[model samples]
Target: MDLNLRNAVITNVTGNTQDQLQDTIVDAIHSGEEKMLPGLGVLFEVIWQNADEQEKQEMLDTLENGLKKQ
Candidate 1:
């Protein structure tokens, strides 16, 4: 995993406006850079930390479904 991606993204995570946050996610996903995954993992960690139990379950279900589609 990219420790640099984690460091770069995590430090600037505070006070992100919605659009900026969306852009970060979108760019990371669409960048076609192999190193984007750790950034996504960081984002997922942020999401996971903030999610409630039901939401977490939903995320897990979604992930499971996506994996099954592979």
Candidate 2:
């Protein structure tokens, strides 16, 4: 069996509206299930690929600030 999680995740959210996607993300985060991490990573991948340098830097800054709180 050849399973590609990234592809599956992408396919699952392909045409979702902004609200739908936001709900999915919020739910996955609130659920705190290990299974949802891969999907989140895939979503982040898509976001990273499309982001401008400044956007990426902003995300990094936010991530850094978040980790600092941990």
Candidate 3:
């Protein structure tokens, strides 16, 4: 994704209050669990940017399980 579009998405999601952010993230995780590809891809991208190698591996493992559940 282009930087501008990525920034727009981050801005939109993070604009919520802390509680709302938590709710939104929870909803997103459930969406990811269902293998909603676009949602999962967006999350994976964000996690990729911020996660360390070990964290990345953990996330990938979670994602693998999530995909299986789907």
Candidate 4:
């Protein structure tokens, strides 16, 4: 079987509105299921690719802070 998880995840959310997207993300995180990680990762990859350097640094800083809390 051939699987393209990133494409699948992107396609699933392709036409979502901002509220819908937020709901999806919130629901996924609340579920605390390992299966949702790849979908979140694909979303993060899209954000990272589109983000400017300053935004990327902000994300990195937030991630670092989040890790510190764990």
Candidate 5:
């Protein structure tokens, strides 16, 4: 079976409000389920695609700082 996970995740959250989207992200992170990682990756991909270079740098900095803590 072919599963287009990125498309599925995008479709599932397409019309969500800011609050709804925030809640979904928070819930997914808090759940810590491996299945949710791909959905998060898709969301991050959307963000990365839309971000400018400075925004991308900020995100990378945040990720680096986060990883340093672990």
Candidate 6:
């Protein structure tokens, strides 16, 4: 993911009402032990910074699709 896209996603999430998005992101980071793709790191950072239900779902779908390719 590009930084611009990541920012857009975060901005979208910030528009939502979820309050524990940050903690959930932190937990996800801590739980994942494998290394993430370089571009994907931008996505993770975006999720960590700001993520709500819709954004999270989109991010997760992107991630799952990426992993499925491997």
Candidate with top lDDT is 4
- Per-model TM-score on C-alpha atoms: 0.81, 0.92, 0.56, 0.93, 0.93, 0.34
Flag regions of model 4 displaced more than 4 Å: 1-3
Per-residue C-alpha lDDT of model 3 across residues 1-70, encoded as one tens digit per residue: 5577666657777656879866766787776565445543565588699999999899889989999999
Could you give candidate 2's per-residue lDDT for residues 1-70 as a string of tens digits? 1248878888889999999999999999999999888888889989999999999999999999999999
Q: How many residue pairs clash in each candidate?
A: 0, 0, 0, 0, 0, 0
RMSD of 3: 4.2
Between prediction 1 and prediction 3, which has the larger lDDT? 1
Query: Candidate 2: lDDT of 47?
Result: 99
Window of ten residues with lowest summed lDDT in model 2: 1-10
* lDDT (tens digit, per residue) of candidate 6 on 16-62: 54555655456557767544343246646755568878888887898
TM-score of 3: 0.56
Cα lDDT computed for each candidate against the true fold: 0.87, 0.91, 0.71, 0.93, 0.92, 0.62
**After superposing candidate 1, which stretches have Cα over 4 Å from the reference?**
1-7
lDDT of 4 by residue, 1-70 (tens): 1249888999999999999999999999999999998899888988999999999999999999999999
lDDT of 5 at 12: 97
RMSD of 6: 13.0
Q: After superposing candidate 5, which stretches have Cα over 4 Å from the reference?
A: 1-3
Indicate whether candidate 1 or candidate 5 has the larger TM-score.
5
Q: What are the candidates' C-alpha RMSDs?
A: 2.0, 2.1, 4.2, 2.0, 2.0, 13.0
lDDT of 5: 0.92
Residue 50 in model 5: shift from native, Å?
0.4
Q: Model 5, residue 14: displacement in angstroms?
A: 0.5
Clash total of candidate 3: 0
